[model samples]
Target: MDTNETTATTLQTKQHFEVLDGLRGVAALAVVTFHFMEWVYTDSSKNFIGHGFLAVDFFFCLSGFVIGYAYDDRISKMGILNFLVSRIIRLHPLVVAGSILGLLAFLFDPFGGHPELYSTGKIILTFFCSIFLIPLPVIADRGFNLFSFNAPAWSLFWEYIANIVYAFVLYRIGRSYLLLLTILSALAICYIGYRSGNLLGGWSGPTFWDGSVRISFSFLAGLLIYRSNWIIKNKLSFIGLSILLLLAFIMPSSKWNWLSEPLVVLFYFPILIALGAGATLTPVWKKICVFSGKISYPLYMTHYAVLWMFGNYYTSHKPGTTQLVLIVIAGLILLVGFAYLVMVIYDIPLRKYLSNKRNERLAKQKAGLI
Candidate 1:
């Protein structure tokens, strides 16, 4: 998931919607739990959080809503170049760090598998490409997929494409046209999800189009929700909303007669976002929201690399239920701690530095000093 900022005017006039922020964190955490379960079960159908990958779609919708909320008013003034720069500053730092972590993990376990898989030169190449969020071609012989260092980076690549679409095309379109696009994207989502039998096909090379359709539908739906200024007026419980989101992710797709993923993406998620927008939090809930928002992005971008480490350990050891449970508990703590540490030590500081640099550059450009 990505974080977005408000325009100067919106910043002055609009209250930050903390519920959406908290939901993002909730979804990220679900993803982490899902991955942990996936490694343990090694069977998608048997996994506990069977539909947790839907969190990625939730993330796409959230990104669209926040981006539209933040930038819709200022698109004309900000210009495409500036908008792209702003997104890069917000998203690229953790991406680079994640890739580096992935590379280190690979280096430490280079000989664990087929020695011919990734040569040192190939690993270095993957590292360099990953920093720029490039998806390398999959090497079937070696079982390599794009962003080999960190698989989750695949979503960030699509997110960048969606950002470009927003800045260049979607921002300028009339509401009617945008609505048409949203409807078409929704249909695409249903069709793709039905054909694939699941919504989990997006991270690999052959199924990249499946991923594309998934993002397009959710992102556009989110953009439409923001543009329509839709929100539930009745007081909604933050805890209730949180539970609904978790259930949406945790429920098995087959439990809803195999229609859960499509229904959730096409209807539930957008409705959820609207309801979340209207949520008013108590002081305690407010702090929860703030802390959740602070760690959501870092958790998402960093957890997979840690998971890889966990997977390595799991494969090497044989543990009983109690021992396995302890490992899971400790792993969760370590993942959360690492995500927060990255936020405090790297993500926040790097974004701030990049933002300051962008401001300086923009100042220079305005002053004809560039």
Candidate 2:
């Protein structure tokens, strides 16, 4: 979810695993495609990319590895405050962008929705909670999602929780304690799977705590991979690893979802992360991987606004199978392009300005102290 380079003197990760970065983009694309497929296949078993939701788990695992690799040795010197500030700069710009886009889609969704049903005050309150990452699952129309305007922000909420825990607790702990915690989280994941029949319960109000469980194991496993040096040296290039990664998402759905989903989350995703970190990146694929990595977060954060529109369009029009295919294919391409535009026009420049401003303040404060 972060970048390949460390532009800041101390805040950025020293080096990135380019293959891992490229995998993030692949996961993000899978997620969007899955979202589109999900609407049509209300019974998820029929969805071709039934397991695409696991991409979020992959993301959590990758985030943990990236965070540990980036901050394990440096967080103490940077101090908790600076570390968190850096995280906010790295992550929150898109959070705000997503919220704003979600709100606009809500207010003006031409295909469907009843904006007049809610008063201005409630809408305003919901928007505030969303931008601040406060959960208010109050909108029935939006399936009582933790963040009504932006459904995917649910993961971001847990991501913030993980970041806070890292600053206050996870960073100081030894690998032994971290391993114990990871094991506990793995159990929680299994329990959730057995109880719920799948690993897909974290976005809405009823399944609120499921988000916590999902992030727990994957993120911890990721951190564990980094600390344990679990990188498996492999000849799999970016394209090879990508095809392998896509298999998990495209796997068939069946009665074993309860067991299968957790296994993938607990083991398969961690292995992918390890392989991705160690995989070779050919010179030919380096630029593609970089762009994929750079565009991933923006794509993830921004694509949902139009999802609502698509859902509305589908419900009202009930387009035929061929039309649906065309729409989804076109939607994916357009969304990717739109995400890139937003990344260039808004997210990157805003983050850069904030980073520069924060760096200057740090310099002035150091000068004053001297």
Candidate 3:
């Protein structure tokens, strides 16, 4: 390829913020734990990881910073359609994979689930909508989640939306305008938190728009962190940062969620992102951090499939305290292993194939232009 042609291709092989990647994995683990506890505890106040849902906010904020860092400069050269296809290739394969797992779990959930109640037409539509990231919350058995088959896919839907908006609107704006938007989004988050009690909307049909505001602020804050050179060089290292991130998840829930949730999302997470981007990674932790980051997304997307099954099993069997403890511990280990397998067997290979096609298509387009 010529110089111009090469410049037009994707530049995603750049080095990552390894510490941030590790924190993401930590947060993903917290989310899975939270999902498990929510089924057993029902009451947030009793759940140790009551605030685990905030991990999604952290993901959004991290996305903003990473997206800006990765694409803000190169997007102009690669163009919007190519940028989006690159995102789809990176993200959608798992979306499809997760949806399929969820569908299977829903149908064959030997523990529970009444799939026979829904017609074939409804089930088919739900599956297709999930693959396309369309919001369809009609499955009452599944808490009417926006994507019943794979509930966590709800955030991925907003993530796709944010990517499109960034390609068109976010990248071109000056830092001042970006800061202004971030502030406005922060205000919305506070209002939503105060109105509802916590930053845990956007996964269901009724609270769908609630997710929009949740992502809006966190993503903007993250993007601003990158554009404004907000990196905070620190010596806490990945271990210390992981502890700090976990505190937010394990925090006690209370009537104070309205105040505390927004504060964490609006301030604590952005600060952590900055610190994570700059924190040192010890040689001992390097491989661990890399593995954590690589497995984070797959863990986040795929764990929910088992979560539905776990919920049914929990309700049907009502395992004793000892059994519940063992089940959850084993569940965490097995889920992590499953996520690793999916990453290797399904996600990585598919993304590699799709990315190759994307490069070839770009090359052909470049030749046509020439």
Candidate 4:
């Protein structure tokens, strides 16, 4: 533990975080694939390669780990308000922009299709649910129904839920208690997912409870990984991915399905830890994954809308595979471009303003009278 060794380790850790970011990019791609391929998935077998929904889970778990690492000190000292402000500022701007874009996309579908998709009830509800990030099954049941708008944003609801739990319960209780609570909560979600009959109902069903129960494991598993100091070294990424793939395939689709939920929960933890670990272990991975991580949020938020726009255009023409591929590529380009635009225009500026305002108010309050 001399200075040289410490210096080398520090550099490695920084590199690893960059790789974790790249994995975030990978996760983003997964979900985007899932969205783009949803129409053709039946033909492609149930394998569902894009299965980006799983990426959302990865993001949540990653968030739990990153938040634990990033704000453990802040939570320990200045408390929850500042922690919450930072999160809100970071999250809300993109969310708002995504929602607006989604609304516009749905409103102007290429075929002039499903205008009522933006009916008063639906529009108001979607806006309201999104504002709170309440995992409402607003449009998922439609199944290739691009009209419901902002389909992927559903996961953000659970993100908010997990954050609330983290801020109030997990942080206050300390890592040990947080671990206990996460385990217990994960078990509860598993039971609910099992009892509720697989929990993936048609878009018409109530989304809040079903999705929250199904995905809480992602967040909890993340917290578990973060609390353990062993994860810092990059020893476990591929081993974790293999286990998840094995379980995802071998595990039956049966309701409650034996160890399905727990398996998923178990599989997810290691996969993410391994992802974080690999960045530490390998330089190449670190370089690619970190770039992906930086654009990950915007990619996740904008991809669905971009897909809907381009996918609708292609579906109308009934293009050849080459055309579809070109369209898909175009869609991806637009997705990333739009995401970056929203991030730069609405997301970054508002976040800076809000964060600054919050910090200034906090500073003033500390001096006595506000």
My TM-score estimates for the predictions, one after another, are 0.93, 0.96, 0.97, 0.78
Query: On a 0 to 100 scale, what is the lDDT of residue 248 in model 4?
Result: 46
Rate residue 51 of model 1 by lDDT. Answer: 83
Model 3 scores a TM of 0.97
Clashing pairs in 2: none
> Residue 219 error for model 2, in Å?
0.7
Over 102-201, each residue of candidate 1 has an lDDT whose tens digit, in order, gives 7776666532433256577776777788888777855442235568777888889899999999988999998789899999998887787677777787
Candidates ranked by TM-score: 3, 2, 1, 4
User: Residues 1-370, candidate 2, lDDT per residue (tens digit)?
Assistant: 1221233444443556889989999999999999998889998888999999999999999999999988898788778998899999999999999999999999999999988899999999999999999999998878898999989999999999999999999999999999999999999999999999999989988899999999999999999999999999999989899999999999889989999999999998999999999888877788899899999999999999899999999999999999999999999999999999999999989999998888778766767953
For 1-370, candidate 4 gives per-residue lDDT tens digits of: 4322343354456524665676667667666766777654443235345234445556767777777766554564546765676677888777776777777777776653465644688767766665555544545423433224566666666676778878887766666776676677677656755565443421234444555654566666676676775464445553354345344433334434335545555565456555564434356655555556768898887666666665665567777888777866777777777777877787778877886687667657767778
Top model number, TM-score: 3
Candidate 3 clashing pairs? none
lDDT of each: 0.81, 0.92, 0.91, 0.61
Comparing 3 and 4 on lDDT, the stronger one: 3
